[model samples]
Every structure is written in structure tokens, then in C-alpha cells.
Target: MFRLNVTTLCAIKWDCVIVDEAHRLKNEKSQLYKACYQIKTRRRYGLTGTIMQNKYIELFNVFDWAAPGCLGPREHFLEYYGEPLKQGQRISAPERFVRIAEERKQHLVKVLGRHLLRRTKQETIGHLMRGKADNVVFCKMSDLQIQAYRRLLRSPDFQLLISKDLPCTCGSHLTRVECCHRTAPDGVIWSYLHRENPDGCECCPLCIVLPCLIKLQQVSNHLELIKPSSKDDPEKQKKDEQFASAALGEDAVLVGGLQQDESFMGMSDAQHCGKMRALEKLLETWLSKADKVLLFSCSVKMLDILDRFLVRKAYSFCRLDGSTPMGVRQTLVDSFNNSPSKQVFLISTRAGGLGLNLVSANRVVIFDPNWNPAQDLQAQDRSFRYGQRRHVTVYRLLAAGSIEELVYSRQIYKQQLFNIGVNGTSEKRYFEGVQDSKLYKGELFGISNLFRDLLETVFTSEIIENHEERLTGIHRTSSEQCAKQGLLGEHAVSSKLEIEDDIENSELSALSQEQDGIEDEIESPNDTQSCSESQYEHILKDAGVLYAHRNEEVVNLGGAVQKHKRPKTKEQICSMNDPKTLIPSFVVDEHQRLATPSTLKILSENGQEDDTVGQKRKYEEIFKLEEMDETTKWFLSGSSLCPTQSIDCCKAVFK
Candidate 1:
């Protein structure tokens, strides 16, 4: 009917066609794009809150519709402009390429700036809103979920997904896809069923990349998502049963198992999920405080799980997802806002991420993250936007050291790219690649990293401090301050800070000769500070919180809420700005145990150490490192090596 109406609509020869939410026209190959293009019009205009979400190519598609050929051919634009900008943004990119990338970025901005009319949310709606706090809550997986996750990684299906792109071990110099794994031993092509495929066939021996990822993601959310739905075919159901049984035990095949039984007094099904357990605690606190909550998940199945949990807990809530009727969504939103009894609004991220005014709910919990950062951002805006009176707090619950971390990492990567492209902002190049890949692997992209377990203990204070600096825009303290803090300890505490200030000159002059070249390296803009394993202090109070930090509150001036620079105490600065300085001298000496021989020599000359035997042992370790393979050395180097550099270094040396 839309096709027929579209033809009649086009015949009218409209004078103008204005498109709202114009980013939808990003895919020129889409039917909607083609249909919209058929309309006869002399003047074309488009409006969108987000013109470019994940890539520069999206901007090309939007511009192509508004003013055809303004940005030139897609292939030409991508090659000459997009690719260079992306390459330049890489952490491992050479200094020369970074210059070229900046040049390309400036040129593209010039071209787009002519037709683009941009206004940020801060500019438009800043006056109407209060300060918002964003918090990332990392939830530890349940014992069952952890075992199931590890087991799934070793499954044949997952192994095949990862192995297909690897250089064949047979030394064929061809990828497994091009060589042995191309066809099965039975001469049948290897492929898994598409997640949306209605007519299920016999389970294939091999798995597709996307389906395998969905399975992994499901395990992180709730094991119930991995289980076959009731609508699935019997064959598919049987295969899913076997798959779950193989990863988990046969007892896990019953979804929530005996948790439904009133007689069963063990942990509830909701408690079995790490995210749900966190949500349970949060909801208890928030509801008791009379604070409304908006819960969002990318999966409707996850929403269903939440719905059951809410019902079992006897909490009043409203739900909106893809299954909800278009007309009814607004009604649900209005009811949630007007009725104080509706303490929770269960929303699917994709379905309710946009065009919803959920300001009544001051607390938002993102149960799962989306690959696209914009979706998550939009969801946050539902509560944090204009007319929100109460201070909004957003909790992004993620499984600790799991696929969710990788997903969140990619979100930050894309967000940096977006900021660099649209806002003309400079960002720290923390990743090796701009895009995640299935065919190739890097620090941020790889099946091996995704599958491997990350020790909560391995990350250093520098990692947290760097992250805090990026998010909160606070300057870090100098190494001199760090050394002073270490030496002074609690003895330096004084009501009047003038005493500490008075000692600054003497401290600097006395340490000038001793610190020499180390100060320059420590102060380098691109260089991130490194600490030894013993200096790896726990940043989060709870092991479940893989990482947690909050942005400072914005100052309300007139009606606008904007961030203001404020004075901070020594403790606040150490905790928020330079976490590494909190490490004591003992930890530093322990780190010195792994120092290079040059450092050992300097330490002896400075009379900082008298243990010559330990120094000798440290010097021998350097020789041992030289003898070890590059891969082994990378493992030993730990946080000292830049992840971007290691990818290239390991690839060249190993193969």
C-alpha cells in the first residue's frame, strides 16, 4: 500500500520534501531511501539530532539525500577522506599520518560546514535541565554464568568462528576459510542458521560470526536468552538444548531450573544473573527512596526476564518494546510520568531510545549496552533531557571482564571518532584500530581477547587515572607531587597548606639532579604512566565493580546547568586525578625489581638502594627478557607496553 501511495504521492510534484530524523536515509540501498528519492521536488531539506553516529560514511549518505553529489562519490570520499581520518585516529599511527589525518578532517569539515546547521544539546536545552551523573557498574558473573561462559568459548562452534580467519596451521599460507575450513569433511558447506531464520534446518557443524556473538552476549545477560524460545522449531529447540547442556550441565537446560518451585529456597532465578542481582539491589534502594527508575535492555527477552523479576518482587512497572503498539507507546510513557505508582518503566533500547520524554524517572539503569554508543546516549537523554527536575543518575550495568567490556570499549572508540569528525575535537588514541574486525585481530579487536579471562588484578592505577582524566576533564598531578606524597605520607598533613607550599622550592632543587631525564618522560603528553604489579591497587571498593567513577555535578546558573571549575583537596586530587601517586615507596621498590640495568645503576649511584644482589638479579632478568621470544616478552612487559604497539610488534615477531 505504501508503494502504491508513494507512486501517487510522487506524481503530485511536490514543491518541497522535508525529512525528519533524516539519519534513517543513511542506507541509499534501502527501500525507504529509494522511495523517498522518487519524490519530485526542487528543494530538499533534512533534520536530524544525530547526523553521523558511528562513521563519516553515514554523513555522506545523509548529505547525498539533502544535496546530491555535494560530497562526491561514496568510494572517493571514503578513500580520500574517511579512511585517512580513521587511520590517523589510531593510537599506533605514526606522527606523520596523524598530521595527514588532521588535514583530511579539516578539509571534510570545510565541505560539510557549508550546508550543515549544528547545535549541541548543551546549547539548545542546557538551561532547562539539572546536572546528570553517569555511572558504570560492572557486575560479576554468577558462578554458573562464569563456568558457562568459559565452556562456551571452548565449544566447537565458537572455536570454528575464531579459527576461520587464522593462517592455516597446515602451513598453506592461506586463511582457514580459504583452505581447510572452507568445506566440511563431509563435503557440505559450513554455515549456522541466521538468528531470524523462520524455517530452521538441521544444525550446521560450523557457526556464523553474528550468531556466535549473540550467544556469547546472551550468556552475559541471562542464560535464558541462550535457551531456545517456545516459537522455535523442535529441531532448533533440541539443538539449543544440546548446545546449552554442553556449555552448562544438563541441569541448566531447564532455563531457570527449579527456582520456580516455592519449596526451592536457593538463590532465585534473577539472583542467578549478575546484572539482575545488581538491579535487584538497586531497585530495592531506589524504590524505598521513592525514586523512579527506567530500565532499558537491547533484548526484549531480557526485558521479559526483568518483567518476571518485577512481578515476583511485587513492584509496579510499565513496559514498552517492539511488541508494543505504536499508538500505545505514548500512552504508556504518559501514564508512567503522571502516575507516581509507576516506579519503573521497562523499555527496550531500540524501541524506546528515541522520541520519548521519560523525565519523571530520575534514575535510569541500562541493563545491557548496545554496539552503537548513540543508542545508549539517546536512552540516557530520555531521563536526563529538558524539564527533568531531579538530578538524573544513570547506571550502566555490565558483566565484569566479559564481552560487555569489549562492547563498551568499542562504544568509546566510535564516540572518539564521532567527536573527532563532527565536533573537531582531539582525543587520546587509546585503540589500535577504529573498527572491530572478524577477519583480523588487534588489541581492541580479536576473538582471543574476547574469549580470554582478564584478571581484575592486572590493570594499573594509570589505567583508571587516564580514564578519569578523559571522562571528567581533570588534569593529572606531576611525578614530583607523586614522589612528595609518597615520602611525606600522613606526617605532612597540616591545617595550613602553606607549610607544604613553602617546602616546594627546596624539594624541587634537591630532586632536580636525581629526577633528571625521568621527569621529561613522566611529563610527556602521549606517554601514559606505568606501575609495577605490586602497585596494582584495587580501584573499586567491590570486586564486582570492574570500574566505577562519576562525573562532578554541573552548576545551575539562571536556568542552565554547566560544569564549573572548583577547588579540590589533596585526598580528592589523589583519588580522582592521580591514582598512581597513592601507591607507597615499597610498591615502587618492588616495581624497581623489574627495572632495566640503567635504572639499577642510577639507583645505586643515587644511594637509593644498597641491595646490590637484588639489583644484580634485576639486571639478569633483562638478559632473560632478551633471550625470550617477543610474545613472551610482551606478556612479561604487562602495562608498560602500549596495546596498539604490541599488536603490530607481536604479529611481526611471532609469524
Candidate 2:
């Protein structure tokens, strides 16, 4: 009756109804929300730690269900509360609009205060939880992956997908005057799967925007996921073949245009993917220390790759995904927790992120990032929450300078949105020019970033520095600030809740101390010194890393201060081989530095450097060279300037 006749139960009148995980009903259009709305009750109660996740309308839905007309009609609430509050959060919104939005926000909060009793985990159970450190690992893409990525960008289908002004590349289909080179022509409409070419039928037979994106994401993780296999369902394979042709062009090799070399295909899974290589190193270190791990990925196909890799390594692991039977899930979880042989528990972020407590595993790996930051945060909490023991360390892996970075930047945006709505804290506007709504531009928003040719610089200092600053800001919110903002309710001050909170906090502290002792025994002095640095330094040498910080020291890059140059020590100055001694230290103008090209070559129509235009190119190259690379060629050509000042050292090695 509970499963099949939920609506029938709602028909009967009741004095009250209580809802758990009430945020699920945020979408008013959902069947659960509809069923819950149909229930006849005067008093409706909703309970959820996270009442609002992404948008403001969510608050309205939860509130309206609890008390009819409390937030007024949906349209009224949106007009007064939603739009104004969102507008004020924007960096560019007018002063008047910001003022109006603030007023609306205050009123909304006051109204919420009457009905809502919100309490934070820190306040209620801070004593019971151990210290959890979140480290963001930016992994570089394999050489094969980079080639495939560039191949997709060069495809005609990709050009048609992003409706923005770009130099026309369609050979001979239209003249220089009529080449649809400007922003897509008026009335051009694009569906999620397919896009209409502005110049009509001359474009590729299939222009799929979504598939192109999925392919890039797949390449970032593992090229084998997109590689055609006989195991694929016939219809799915047919669709994939069509997409491959459209995305990579008919003449190009499939799956990032990988070479059909036996050597390439015969490479080990870790050798084929950069993230896998990092994971391999981490597993080696962790498993040796007898530390269990919970690894999560958004893609089930990626999990299959991991499963195979684990089998090759002869590592005992248990897996759970959407396909895992409900009855067997608990058994698998118990086996992983109780059995010492089970070294790792692999989980699908969507399937295993919630409800399950894997307290036995102290380390967690978010193999890939999700667009929704909440999903990733939830995955981290599985190990960190009211756990049995140990300090939880979460490693969030991202493909540096790829589409994954864009996804993560948006995650930061969405998180700021959540903070504004719930915690009443607003962050400095980082994505100022990058509009997420319409006419998207800037590095974080549009097609220009996707078509970026230079892999040398993935993220500008402004982008990565701002990203790190914003993350730090989010985690540093104090309980006093929350109280001043009225997020902490009257109920939180109750003696019973306060007593429980104290007990939990003490337990958490005790667990952390115990874990510290264990970690000290496991890692040696040198290992502890470099514990914060990326293990795969060779591959990530040119990648942008978002370093974590602890005790005023950068925690993810050998505990160095994140800067363009670190103050040189006297011992470092004695070695003439040190690049710092080779060139005079000077700060280059960021704007002028970025504008200068890495090389003095000019690409002609056919994508080849043309020596034929040497006269004009020669003068330009000479001018650029005189202005740039004087202090250090390494600084001018480095991938990112946010963390570590090793560019001079790298230059010294070459000299």
C-alpha cells in the first residue's frame, strides 16, 4: 500500500504529517511533491539539514507545503523573494536593485524564522566528528587524451554548436563576405542533442552538442570509455558511431583521434589516463599503510575501467552502483567494512553517496567532479560523518585545463548561490563577466575556452587564485557569524541539544588525536614533508593545481607559499645552476605577458605555420621577443602562475 497507493493515503485527512529529507520536494512538479501536496492536513512539518540547495524557488516549495499561503502563491513568492534576492547577489546588479533585493531577503528570512528550526551539524554534533581535510587534485591529461581533445575542437560540428562570433573555417562553402563568421544568424535554434547549421546543409551530417560534451568528459576520465567496443549494445553503438563521425570528422580516428597503434592499445589502464596514474600512486601509498578507501565516480563506465584495473593489481575491492541489487548493497558494505581483505569500496556518486556510512575507510577519492557541488560534498560526508574512527581525507580529482575545470568553476558559482540563500553570506564576485544565463562569454562561460588552442596556460592567475580564495572563504564561516545572521534558531540553545553537541565534539577530537598517532607511524619524515604535493609531478608539471592550505602553509604543493616566486634562500643562491641566478627577477605585466604568443610562428588558412609571410611575421616576432621572455622563458610559457615558483628552476635545467 505504501508503494502502490501513496496517493490514496494522502486522500485521508490527518492532524499532521512529517516529511524527512524535505529538500527532495523542492521541485513542485515532482510526483512526490504532488502527492505530499494532496494530503489534507493543517499542520505540516518538514525536516532537512539542507533546506535549500541550488535555487530560491526551492525554499518556496518546502515552505508552501508546510503551511499553505505562507510564502503566498508561487508566482508572488518568485516576484518578491526570488528575483530580487538573486539580482542582489550579482556583482553587476544596479545599486537600487541590490537595495530592493536586500529588503526582500530580510523579509523572507523573517517569515522563515517563524516556521523553520534550522541547526548546523557543527553546532549540534561538532564534538563527535573528526577533522576532515578536503584536497583538490588537478590531474593533467595524457598525451593521447590531449590529441583527441584538440581533434574534437577542430571539427566542423563543434564550430556550429557554439553560437558565437568566430573566424569562419568552412572551406569554400561560402565566400569571405557570406561566411557566417559572425555570431550565429538570427532565428538560429539549437536543441540539446542537435544544432542547426547557419549556412544550412554544408555542415556535418550530425551536429550533437551534448554528445560532443560527453565525449570530452569521457576523454578527460579515460579514452577507453569512448572507444568503440563489441560489448556495446547494437543501437547504442550505431548512435555512438554517428556521433564519433560528427564530432571527430569522418576521416579522423575515433575516440580523440587516437592512433591505431598496437603499442597505444596495449598500454596499461594507468598509462592511458592521467587521473588513473595519480590514483595508482595514491592507492600504493594508502594500501601499504593499511588504510581503506572509498572511491567514487559519476560514470559507471569509468567504474568498469577501475574494476578491471583493480583486478589486474590483484586488489580486493567491492563495487556498488545503480545496477547493484538493493538486497546485496548492505552485504557488500558490511563485507568492505568488516573484512580486511577488501581494500577498497568503489561507489557511484549518485547511487552510494547518501545513506551509507563507510566509517571504516579514512580516505575518500572523488574520481571525477560533478556539476552540482552538493553531490560531491555529500560523497565526502560519507566518510566524515558520525563515523566509527579516523581523520577523513578527501581527494577531489579534476582534469587540469579541460572542460572539467569549467564544470568546477560553475560548482563554485552554485555554492556561492547556496551560501547567499542559506547562510546569508555573499562572496566577492569572481565570475563577473561570465554570465551563466544568456549570451555567455568570458573563460568560464563560452565556446572560446572549449576551442582554446594553447594548452600551456589552462587557467589565468585571476581564475585559479580567485577559485582558491573563494573555497577558503566558504569553509571559514564562523558559528558566531551564523548566529548574527539569524541562521541559528532558538531551538539550538536548548540544554539537551547543547549537551549532546559537547559530547559529539569531544569524541571527534579524541578520534582525530588517535588518527594522528596512526598517521605518524605510517608515514616517514620525508613522506610527511612532501605529503601535500602532487605525486604525479611529471605529468602535472604543466597543469594548474588548486592547492589546499593548512596552518598558513599551502597544503597541496610541498607546503610552499602559492606565488609567482618564493624568496630565495642563501643555500639556493650558491648553486649557479639555479635558474633564479640566470635572469634578473622582475614581474611581467599580466595583460602584456598573456597577449604575447609562446612562439613567433603564424598559422595560415590550412593550420600550418606559414614561412611565406616572414616579412610581416618576422617584425612582429622580433617585437614580441624583445618585450617578452627576457626575465625567464619559463615564466612566459608556463601553464599556470598560481601555485609554486619552480619555473625558474625548470629554466635552469634546460640552460
lDDT of 2 by residue, 357-470 (tens): 788998899999887777888888788777545666677777766787777766666665555555543333456543344443545555555545544544532453454444
Which residue pairs show collisions in model 2? 127-504, 127-505, 128-504, 128-505, 148-256
User: Candidate 2: where are CA atoms >4 Å away?
Assistant: 1-3, 92-103, 164-207, 238-268, 433-436, 439-456, 464-655
Measured with C-alpha atoms, the lDDT of residue 95 in candidate 1 is 66
The number of the candidate with the highest lDDT is 1
lDDT of 1 at 604: 24
lDDT of each: 0.60, 0.57
RMSD of 1: 16.9
Cα distance off (Å), candidate 2, residue 194: 7.7
Query: Any runs in candidate 1 off by more than 4 Å, and if so which?
Result: 1-4, 183-207, 250-268, 436-441, 446-543, 550-655
* Candidate 2, lDDT over the whole model: 0.57
The 10 consecutive residues of candidate 1 with the worst lDDT sum are 552-561
